[model samples]
Target: MSVENVRPVQSNCLLEVCVDSVAGLECAIEGGADRIELCSSLELGGLTPSAGFMQTAAHISPVPVYALNRPRSGDFVYSVLELDLIERDIEQARAAGLDGVVIGVSLPDLRLDIGALTRLKTAAKGLDCTLHRAFDLVPDFDVALEQAITLGFSRILSSGGALSAEQGLAMLRHLCKRSSGRISIMPGGGVGALNVPQFMALDGIKEVHGSCSSPSEAVHAKVTALGFASESSKHTDASKVRALKAALLVPSSD
Candidate 1:
């Protein structure tokens, strides 16, 4: 569906939960997520999920599912072949019936890759597109914000160049004000029940993105059985998602 045609979320302040597995998807949905960002290997900083996974999540999720289209873990600057791969991923997401795709591209100078993004946007066609956290790596936030708006991204997911949304509150507010409804500035990274109230106070934050993740003992055991030194397996926690949603509804102290 076109970005404009996407259904309004159930709550005024939408909660977007990022999940890597079917189990995580189930948890996010039960936890009252308004939307889901389907991906794989969150430890690698999120890679494009398999088509089967995307189809399964889209089929099972009640809310809109937006697939992450990153080809690799390292950086936002991609080679031509890598861009082609991303284009194919976007096509796969569309064919899988996902509501949107999250993506971003950058130049060596840390500027937005307008040409590459334009082609990716074309490949996305009718689906809603979000410029992902790659926005944080850009050298100039103001310039990048205008480029994202001109490129027609439905929203930009960022932590305002800080390590976490709470740490970047000031820049988040600045970007939100500068956006002026032309595009959405979604505060993500380290957002959870405890700090969501701070974001709610920001005037133009219509949506928030987070993993709301916690360590999973089951998965950790499996990894250990395979002889890998598993630090800990993380998955979206249903209770955390519910808590965040509840916190978003409470009036901010502002």
Candidate 2:
């Protein structure tokens, strides 16, 4: 790592892919992702995965597995019960020997709930805590950034409140410069190999997150003991993972 690249924590210009399935987890590892954010129900933003799944991923993943501690998909505002679930998920991830947990909470008015955030951070204790995309919903991005730093969040994944990281690149750059090494600004939501370098070249970004997905049409077969095999499979994009990794390897002039 270069001196300028020395973020508050160790920084790597690599892919942090979200895996909703065991096969996806393995694919992420095979493609050389720097880290994996394990979650379920990618269709609904993403919720906490089963403890068994968390354990299995941790046991076999070659890279760090950061379990998603979210309880639902709608808004980031959480009830007391939801908060409890988040804490429990964090504990389960720690017990499972995982790397970290990604979580977030904001006021109903779309502002940082410092108290609730502090509670979550405290619960995270020995594990790394990443403030999720909720940061992008904050009423004031700068204040939210400071609050995250004060609350001890190591990093954040955001899209500059825009629909995608590309649209939010300017704000992402501003946030990184304003961060002053206090926190890592990770860009996610619609990131890809083609744009990974753009995000990395922005001031203060050390990591980029996205799912590089492509179409695939491989048939999976099930074999029976009666010397008969049933062929059944759905199209799955198996190339995006590797392609994304390759995109990150393109060295930046900066």
Candidate 3:
């Protein structure tokens, strides 16, 4: 299996579950997630979790937790004020004793904003960093991969520029091989227990990310009517998390 820029698996695949609420956080741990990506709104593709949420997770989670450092919704093209907020949030995650921060910033032309990322990375020094899905938005993954590695990102959560990991398997596999083991290329987006086994054997994969979420049992009719919540809401499901963990043990063709 020797290949250019590729390495052997150093360890078993780790399950990283992304969560928005305290309940989701609890469920992720309870379901055996090796790590947690703390954020505010899954519906918005994950925003920075509040200081309070980080604090709560610090108190509640036994496993390592990383805060998503996105300041707002829309694009990854952040403004100066938003960058300020993101830096503050990175400090907050460290203050809350969280393990790391997930971050990404993009240019108008959809390239990784190197200057902005360098600043954020400086602020997040001494903590782990995961480059978020904004990597998928880049025009060239090979270029972005080099930039991300140089910026000191410990891992990257991406769906290979596609809507789902299954649909982007070829690119994802290439990224894994290309990354070797210099930086972890974690496949995510529409990932779940049912299909996790498929990703277990990539050349440089060491971790995988998923929401492990399901429809909220009681979507409170009144809450939706008042526009406080969407009628079709989802929450982290402990069973899904456990299933994903179990799935990771299976061998894969890939």
By lDDT, is 1 or 2 better?
Answer: 1
Task: Record all residue pairs in model 2 with backbone atoms less than 3 Å apart, i.e. clashing.
Answer: none
Give candidate 1 regions above 4 Å deviation.
1-9, 218-222, 225-229, 251-254
Q: Candidate 3, overall lDDT?
A: 0.87
TM-score ranking from best to worst?
A: 3, 1, 2
Q: Give lDDT: candidate 1, residue 154.
A: 96
Which digits, one per residue and each the tens of the lDDT, describe model 3 over residues 84-188? 999999999999999999999999999999999999999999999999989999999999999999998999899989999988888999998888888998999
| TM-score of every candidate relative to the true structure | 0.92, 0.85, 0.93
Candidate 2 worst ten-residue window by lDDT: 1-10
- Stronger candidate by lDDT (2 vs 3): 3
**Between prediction 1 and prediction 2, which has the larger TM-score?**
1
Query: Worst 10-residue stretch by lDDT in candidate 1?
Result: 1-10
Model 1 C-alpha lDDT versus the unseen true structure: 0.89
- Candidate 2's displacement at residue 97, Å, is 0.7
lDDT scores of the candidates, listed in order: 0.89, 0.80, 0.87
Score residue 135 of candidate 1 by CA lDDT.
94
Q: Who wins the TM-score comparison? A: 3
